[model samples]
Target: MLQTAVLQWPGRWTKKPRAAAPPQFRDSSQPASLTVKSPKLAVTLEPVQHEDFSSLVVSVATTRDRSAFARLFEHYAPRIKSFLLRQGTDPAQAEDLAQETMMSVWRKAAMFDPAKASAGTWIFTIARNLRIDAIRKARRPEFDPEDPAFVPDAEKPADEVINADQMGCMVREAMAELPDEQALVVRMSFFEDKPHAEIAEQLRLPLGTVKSRLRLAMRRIKEHLGDRA
Candidate 1:
């Protein structure tokens, strides 16, 4: 599976470890906890060891740990696939993106600095950038050069759109501004645009409580956004 996954990667592997008598592997049993803090959002994670993939990413980086990488893929690839599907990507393409995204994780794991972002956030950013690339490749000029209505544009390239990275950074900043409980709910809301009832169920919170927190979070985000609100 690792061998198959490598082929989907955009670049060659920079590191590949030889097998050893005493294998180096991440403690899969360790409860993962990832806390992402920023100037705009202050989310507190309730998941074990921040959902376990951050350290797995670090392990893949340092030791070229295939076992750890496998765990990471098993956990996140399906979620990535679901996200792409929700974004209107074809199912087969979404499946491809899931593998490709994990391959990217393997290639870019070395750059996963926990201090800057959690493993989940880092991986999400990579998937988002890949999606952006996909979108740009599909974008064609709306106007034909031979058309009489065609006019040369002075600024903003035809393909220029809301940058996924910049928007993600802004969202993280906005999330950072929310109180812990609100931020946590906001994060879940961001996931697949999950409904509040589902989020409440996952967090074991009352549905009304979830709705109320979301309202408060939206209010705070609007305040920070001004006209963008």
Candidate 2:
């Protein structure tokens, strides 16, 4: 049996036999008979042309439209509940979390801005955030301040470290392949961190000549790097 309850402004708790289309929740102006489907879920989600769902939210915020809010709640509650259940939350807790998530939607409706995000996107984010908080609260680990191992290690992704090492190797190999004069200018400019003008003065080369050599070295490096597919 499927039952949906709207707490703030109550709606009839419709009941249906097993294997039925999802519940119907009508908006102030638009009634939703949404049919939402995914690999993990197959629920009723009537297709309504929402060229502008943001406007629907506006109706609720400005006019206190219960119907408008009801439509959003009915459509999303099951989806949110299912998502939480998939994450290993108990059935009772999942239902409660879904209700709380929709309740938050109603409370925070006035803050919704169409310019920033669509109604669906905004509501989904709210559900996700609430789910995270609920899970964390449910499974909070004990911590002791005096424990030496209590300090969490900062983790850099292995891929990022590997990429950095690869780039360094490429640069070294590229420099080794460069002519003596070009390599010297490249090294002083990049490795020694010397200014181009200073390098020109120290090497007794004109400024334009130094810049031209550095440009040539960069072009060679780019060529060595080759184009990605």
Error of 1 at 147 (Å): 40
Q: Candidate 2: TM-score? A: 0.40
Model 1, range 135-206, lDDT digits (tens) per residue? 546433345667987875456454543343434445555655555566556645553334677666656667
Clashes of each: 12, 8
Q: What TM-score does each of the candidates earn?
A: 0.45, 0.40
Global lDDT of each candidate: 0.61, 0.58
- The candidate scoring highest on lDDT is 1
Off by over 4 Å in 2: 1-52, 138-229
lDDT (C-alpha) at residue 182 in model 2: 67
Alpha carbon lDDT at 15, candidate 2: 29
